[model samples]
Target: MRGYLAAVAGSEPLTPVSRDWARQRTDLEDEVPVVHEETVTGRRYEGDGIRELRIPRFKSVAGRSGDLTQGEWAETALAAAVLADARPVLSPRWKSQQRLTLGRFTPVTHIRVVEIGCVDASRNVLFEGTPEEAHHRYVRMAEARVRAVKAGGDYLPGQGCGACELVDICPAVPSRPGFLGVDSPPARRRSWSMTTARDYRTCPARAHLKDLFLPRAEAAENTPAIVRGQAVHTAIEELHSRSPVRACASTDAPATPEHWRAGRWEVTGFQARLGTQMVGDHALVCPLHELPGDAQVYPERSLVVHDPDADVVVVAKTDLLYRRTDTWFLRETKTVRSLDESDPLLAYPQLALALLLAHEGAVPGTTEEGTTGCRVELERLTGSGPVLTELDGDDGELLAQARRIVTEHATHWHADEEYVARPGKHCETCPVIQWCPSRPEKSAA
Candidate 1:
């Protein structure tokens, strides 16, 4: 009985269109119509009786690589009339094709964004309006790159892993030996971090050499100031899960022998400045400490999101994340020499990305998500006290600015000829100072 019903369902009449209807998409293939081998196209749907759409078993309605690229959108637009979040049912083309391949289904969490075509209105007429073109500029850039490549410029080292053989000699690549067996030189994909982004803005050559090519400096983490900063950051992080007072009694302690060995400050001095001294209208810690008992904390949460405008992936590891009531928050902690109203860290890119993610509900945080927005906190644990700056919880302006900056940087990231070393204030602290060919000494020569 089951086999008989399955056969009737498989042969049931429904609208069929050429396989190319789902295969070739103009979005990916430079707007060219693609013809496919499968012939079943052009079926008409009539009075609905148990309406269902049949698709290949292995693929998704969202589409994937190769011929199916963007094909899911076709299924999406076609099925938009009535069905939504429709799970495609998999079945063999013929009864004898395979008895084992009877029925399988895959589910999606949410389509994220789906554009359903008009079913009630005229279908034959072309409707020209489009989705919110927030990233249209980046789309144009992608198109331009395609044009550039076809004109004999086949490749360029993007802000990502440049697969070209010339990466070894490329100035955009670092020239230093890595630490141990680990090489952290940035590649074309998953390459742009907050640090690398700053490096690129400050000095492209330094970015190429230190961030891309050279080995990370040995014991860089052991620097006195760095260690102290790490201690403060650790204290702040663990404070979310455990009280600073209770944590000191066990291995959960924030200030450790590591502080004594850090040699940056007398342990007493460090504690006085960090623990006893800092003051503010309401320090970052105050809000953190006041957070409700049930509020969850995510420490050093690493985030990666694609900046479509720049056509690059932007990566960030936030110092801390927390939620209160229903609102989510992201914070960046800094043990700085001083804090001012105009502190550069106030407008930092990492915070911007975090803000954007929180707003988009890209990762878990707020129960309210976009409606409540994410609060961004920048705090400096100074000798004077902790100085804090808060962004409007709902302000998305900073996020937009961050995307623009990254996009602008990415537009020029592929320029191999522009890696000419230049001395700037940034050189004083650059890790790869020895590798720079444009240093004052090298320039004087």
Candidate 2:
């Protein structure tokens, strides 16, 4: 992004004023440095031709710059139309940066608006044309998407519940006062999830830094194993999302599992092959297998519930949520190099949330009477083969164990004010170590 910015800013004397921008000077090939910042409303950019509405992508996730869906194009076009119609204004921040005298900023409408990407500063335009053209595209393509967003219906319990003011009264998120089993009052309203719990247990600073959305080292975060796991999940998810839902076949595994590619995630060699085996294993124990065609399946569904007593929103993203007639089953899938002899719930604490939701009959569509029709399952795809485990949601003993695991994980996190670092081996792959105050310095080799 800095490279692109520097290229466009095109400063004189081949010298960029900002030290951050100067860092990219060596790598920047096209430098048309300009101090003038253009804006429509609050937007800021430099240069001309078709005025651009840049979509900034900071993460090295699987995606392209200009390959947008129709709805996405429509949305971007609508925004571009707004930019085209509005007059430009010089931002106060830019003026301050230039150390210029503040004065009335004139508004001048531009004839065209173009949507572009900031990742590589490429001329890969998603949309470009006149304001009228953009508006017509939006009405024809994106208006329904806009309408659906505004016409909110069912109460969804998810990550947003933590910041939601109506969580106390939300019909979907069942309030489980004293759920975290914490005696002290909360320091502030916060959200809790298996990921947060796991990260906090590993290192509080890791959790805090992640919550702050600090830039991470992509190489460390997207290791081969991690990418392989993601690929396997993506393949399974795509299969589950098929129109007129069909059960995954044993032969459905990728033909080239040794070099599998899912979206932007490409894995090769051993990891890729193992991921393929995992995908195939999933077919042996697919929840949709043998189910009726009308069976409803929600893959990668997020469930949120509020704990008013602890002032935390408990969030869980289940791998699969499917219903067979009256009973609803929540399935959690795992891909492991080898299956070890350990408590499944303890090995993968995320399952605790699924178990608790099932036991409490909290998932949407659970029978009003109780958890009679709710079931929880664990599916492991190991090197040997696939193993399926079912946890009776109505089992009191299992429910107690699940509750204990969740509370144990949430207690310290809820009480923590300073997410102090616990640097150790985990620091080797810690994505946010760059921002950690306690990060250990490397010794001279």
Candidate 3:
């Protein structure tokens, strides 16, 4: 009897059982039954919050499996319940379900299969899939669509390849050849930091220019806004190094008037002395200081620190390095719209990279003696500025992910000649649109 039972269990089909088979086999509905039903109509509703839109008991026309067993239904129900509670707590920027039609069948697949995406406020799967994987898939799909359209084979207006950044570079359009001829001159490619390399991977042409051709001027001209932000940040560090420091006892309170003026900065607005509202009748003075610097200020010098395992280089511009007693502090200044300690980009990874570069231990650079911790001062230029915050584990993760992205993208870029475009909303703002071969002729109004 034991051998028979074992054989039965082993030989049982792994294929999902049909809903009818499950219903006939056991009294599962009686155990964990569907309780709620709509009053106005005879339709049954499960109290588990999953409103079953449709449940086709029959096999699909394509001869695919149509069986949704009691166990599978239970799993689906639990998934729906979890999704119900989860959607409300998710981020608002995530993408929802993606609709695709293959031949005559229109199937809507939830983005969750991709693994990495933002969640909506309701905890619903917004952008499904890993961002990196999705980006690559989109690039390949856009390339195929562009090639088809350019070959004049059943290409529809506003169809596939429309969102590609390289739509203007397609050979189908009349002006594309002329445009490529004019802009395809051989030029020297320039070197870029890991951050710049990762950002440009979104555009195939830009990636080719920087990674393959190695042009000096073209690469410099197409640097992303984030890179420019970093450059400006380094310049602020230089300014901060030349200025004096004012230590504050209160976390939210401004600096003292005498200490504020001691720094090499100008003051714009000042309020008069008011009533003292101290804890023990002590007088308190609030002073605001404005530093004379712009966000466009570029660093005069930069130090490159190379990482062999990561296959990239970190560009660091240290503004101030000071030693107090036995420990040394590496101070970096940043200009952001707002500062939050929880933000990874502004915290640990950035500081860690800076510290690693300054120590000259991880990469080749100037070595500092007796370095203990790094200080990051986030300065907002609009109003009362300069809020100092410390970073930890979260920041480190961001840096690691960024490094991985850069290395992976660089590897793909060097291996390919025709870098394909990934189409999306970003394509609307692409600069090379007019030159794309896949672009259709504009209809006259």
Best by lDDT, which number? 2
| Runs of candidate 1 exceeding 4 Å displacement | 1-190, 218-227, 241-284, 290-294, 343-347, 366-371, 396-418, 423-429, 433-445
Let me know the TM-score candidate 2 reaches against the reference structure.
0.69
TM-score list, all predictions? 0.45, 0.69, 0.31
lDDT of each: 0.44, 0.71, 0.32
Q: Weakest 10 consecutive residues, lDDT, candidate 3?
A: 272-281
Candidate 3 lDDT score at position 270: 29
Least accurate 10 contiguous residues by lDDT in model 2: 16-25
Ranking the candidates on lDDT from highest down gives 2, 1, 3
Error of 2 at 277 (Å): 2.5
Q: Model 1, poorest ten-residue lDDT window?
A: 119-128
| Native-referenced Cα lDDT, model 2 | 0.71
**Candidate 1: lDDT of 125?**
14
**Candidate 2 residue runs with Cα over 4 Å from true position:** 1-148, 153-156, 368-371, 440-445
Candidate maximizing TM-score: 2
